[model samples]
Target: MCSRYVGFILLVWFPGALHAQSAARHCPAPALVGGYFVPVKETYSHDFQLTYACENTYKPAVEGWWATSVCQDGTWSHTPQCIDEKGCFPPTIANGKYTHASDGWYEEESVIRITCDKGYEHKNNLATAKCANGTWSSLPTCEQSIKTCSMPPKVPHAVIVHQGYLELFPEDSKVHYECKDGYRMEGSDKNPIVCLAGTWTEYPTCSKVTVRGDHTSTERGTQPGSGGGGGSRPDSGHVSVEVGTGRGHSTSSGPGTQPGSGGYPSTSDTRPIMIPIKDCGTWPLVPNGVVVVQDRMFLKFTCNAFYTQVGPEDVVCYNDGSWSQIPICKDAFCVMVPGYYTYGLRLSENQFIKEGELTYIPCEWNDYSVAVRCTDRRITHTSCCRSYDHQWKRCSIVRENFLPVGSLIKK
Candidate 1:
């Protein structure tokens, strides 16, 4: 009787323990966009807390760089999202104030106008700051209204003609340059190099004279009479001239000595040989753009207004008949037309949306909206969603119609 009672109790307890173990829940590892979590694991037990941090130029969707979330009921309490920290902080100027006032961060590519305090003005007349990426392009500097240029740039094979020691040159100041011996000024000598608006105008260049060869020649000619009584007499015979760096001598015999009676070889005037300019052919054709020929050997690549140029802007045609580098014009921005709209966004004119951005276009006359993304100048529709009320709505549409969903748009 005692053994049977003990076995029954153990059986009941084992089953209860198994049931309790099976009741415990676990949450799968969370995937954080643009960020990562610490103490990574395949699964987390209920109520497990994990810390996460965002990458540079990205911020957590919640508040700060570092955030925490707890696993609960087979899921995370908070969804991890890291968004772009676009735009830059307000620029600080010592004696200038930005005219635009905003409580929040400024948008990318936004310009901020500045006004300097009394008795001061912005240096270089730059009174605006532009936001780019996540930083300000520049900060306007305010200073007393004084314009002076620093020491002029050093010209090759030339020196500044100054009387005394001088550090700064006032605006509208004139400076002259005298080329060194064996070198001559290439630019106009009548126009003096002047400093204007705290900057110097184009400076003259000193070009060295290139000499190929120098030669001096002397020639003597003699003629022999045909008859026995005829004697040799000096005749103006032509001499074939050979040019060389050093002195040269030429002699001519009368035509009778050659069995032919004729004057010496005719004098020929030295003429310079003309060489054709080396050409690499027409500028290379860039897709979606045109090439501007700066000169025969140099070219500048220009893309459409919304396109960006990849590779070097300026290219050179090599002597071997090839371009230094070929540039590609890629679509860089998405165009949003007028009358079409995104929810909560109003557009008075066309808007240029950047790449890697989400665009929501409301379906025609329907409350549903289509989500699209721009990649490499191509628009791809991802999903469709309906409004809460399902009422008719109009969303902003892309610039071009007839573009099938997910088709690449060629500019």
Candidate 2:
């Protein structure tokens, strides 16, 4: 009858009993043993667990006491039993999240979303945070930035040189150019510069090289105009003279009708010849000016000196309309007859010549060339020009060129 009363109370509370014993150590509830561990502080799923009391007796769970009604309702028999619940310990994860990777293989990393700081920019790919061996890992990284620049272009009708070389930045750096001498620049008042991949922009230009040049000839017969007794000489009375010509005057004629008191021929029968004077053809062309005027002879002058039509070094048509002597640019400078200095280096207009610079006399330059000093104007394998300086006379001329001394005419 004692067990009957306990059985009645057990059935009323547990609804059923797994064991018919008056008390048992465990409930008959179904479970996967050793497969799962609830956290130390976690409770069994209430829906999956239950606590019960038999109407026959008062019982408590904390008192180390349990009633037969504690048996799993469906599995226990009509008899009551009591048992203690185990595996209610807390887990390592404190966030109340799940980490049930049933396969025993844990996720290597969680998808974590990341971001960069104020001045930095994102560098690596950012993902989201996910569940793993129970926690999260570090975030992605970020980096800084820089800038770059480009190269320059060329200009037109102007000559532009770096005055040095074309090199990358830190060497022949960025520089703009214009015409060397006579050219004028046309474009933006300001030059443009850029850096391409850290390189500089230095541009070059094209030059305008030209001059307005022309000539005309004036021929007037010798005649004494209304101007009393002094006038131009006639052609008939004049005798053509070529200085240094093996024999003085190349031609001769009768004396003029009215000979000037100076014992020179006059207008009535002599004619004044207007011969254009030029450099001995050995001098370089003047930089910005014409060397001499046309039809005006340089009858006399020293080498490389000032020229004034009336200067003592100059000679012009007299009142008798006849020149005193022959004229040439030789009077304006000490011209170095063009020739080779060394190694076939020929002379040019440049004032300074190096050992390797070329120097040669002017003439039809055949494949032929010879070695000589700076004063020889003859073109031959042995005669060369003197390449000297501004006045053109600084170089010394040789009196004995292949020919005997004074053999060649100073034409």
Candidate 3:
């Protein structure tokens, strides 16, 4: 309808032997000669080169319409291109390849430039080439970029600080042990040191307490000769002591039990017990309170060895029931608070509590009360009364509960 121009853009690409390949004078056919007039031009960069005036396939024997892009500035031609179905050149990208080829004869390398897939490095290179008399050249592009290991911290016990390596196992590296104060802790506290390299798979121990009477503390052991303690005492009741020594003959009453002194065992036909015993002495039948009874019941009167086992020798008869309750064997044994031993339970007679067990005793609740038999030691809030003589067995002169009037007397 409105022809802009069209010389001949028919590269019908081989066929129809009709030589008239001459036409580039701005569309000549269409004044009404036959039927081939195609003129569509937006002016070079104005892009629109599809000129076809029945030339054939690049069809357009040369009639009208042709001038895609390339003619701005000094505009003489070049930049018009269109060749799709794989002619291998500007078949895409705004489609336009045919800057007046044989039509006006204006050519530079023609046109061809396309590079996108292959690791794609986009920058600028959509080339074009048509220099066989046309002209178009400039294409080149290729791009790829992204590169990780960071871990190290925390080396306490076993000293295992991975990634950067710090391992200290059976003995390869790392070692520095130290722990003392009643001894605390066992193995692998990380780098606690010791297995510097050879034979210290794990070492940390000091838990020590020899067990003579009662003791406990544990962290671990086995260093010097290692550890050792073998004890056995049960010959009926144990008296086999090795300390002050005093067995058989004397059971307890007060002074020198003879042999090596320290006696408190007097069995007069078995009489005489005013309660005064130091070591051990006089006994064969001498007993005011020595019951080794067995049947009045099968008997389990167990007091469980205390005077420090040896044999039944000290006075004899012990497997577990030695003198059973004989307390007064004092040489030295008081402040001991573990489980309770010495006078363990008998809170009567001469007031013995070497740390006995009235349930671990610390009782103050309501502030002082349970005071059974007391004498002159003065200390009372709710209770405190004493009066035992049973026949002058002695020990009973204490009354300090509500005393204030002349403060009582009669020691």
Candidate 3: tens digits of C-alpha lDDT, residues 91-189:
222222223334333233344334443223222112333333222222223221000001112221222322234321322334454444444444435
Winning candidate number (TM-score): 1
Give one digit per residue, the lDDT tens place, for model 1 in 1-411. 999999899888799787766676888887777899989899998888988899888876555668898887787777665656875655778867875534345667777877876535565334666677766664568764323455555555678776454656656778888878866676656336775534456666665554546842211111112111112233456422221111122233434343123221222323221111123322355654544446544667676434578899877643223456678766665554455434433435443444666554444433345555566655544233553322223333433333232123322
Q: TM-score: which is higher, 1 or 3?
A: 1
Native-vs-model 1 lDDT? 0.54
| Per-candidate TM-score against the hidden true structure | 0.23, 0.16, 0.13
Best model number under lDDT: 1
- lDDT tens digits by residue: candidate 2, 1-411: 899999888878874454444333343443322222122222222223343342222222222333222234234332232222321111233212333433322333433333433223332112223333333432224432111111223343443346354322222334566655654443334344433222233333332334446642221222222111223223434532221111222222345323232222333334443332321211222211122323344533332211112224454543323344443322211233345443444556322111222333322332223333322332122333222221224333334323221222121
Q: Please identify model 2 stretches exceeding 4 Å from their true place.
A: 1-222, 225-312, 328-411
* Better model by lDDT: candidate 2 vs candidate 3: 2
Q: Which stretches of candidate 1 lie over 4 Å from their true place?
A: 1-316, 320-325, 342-346, 358-373, 376-411
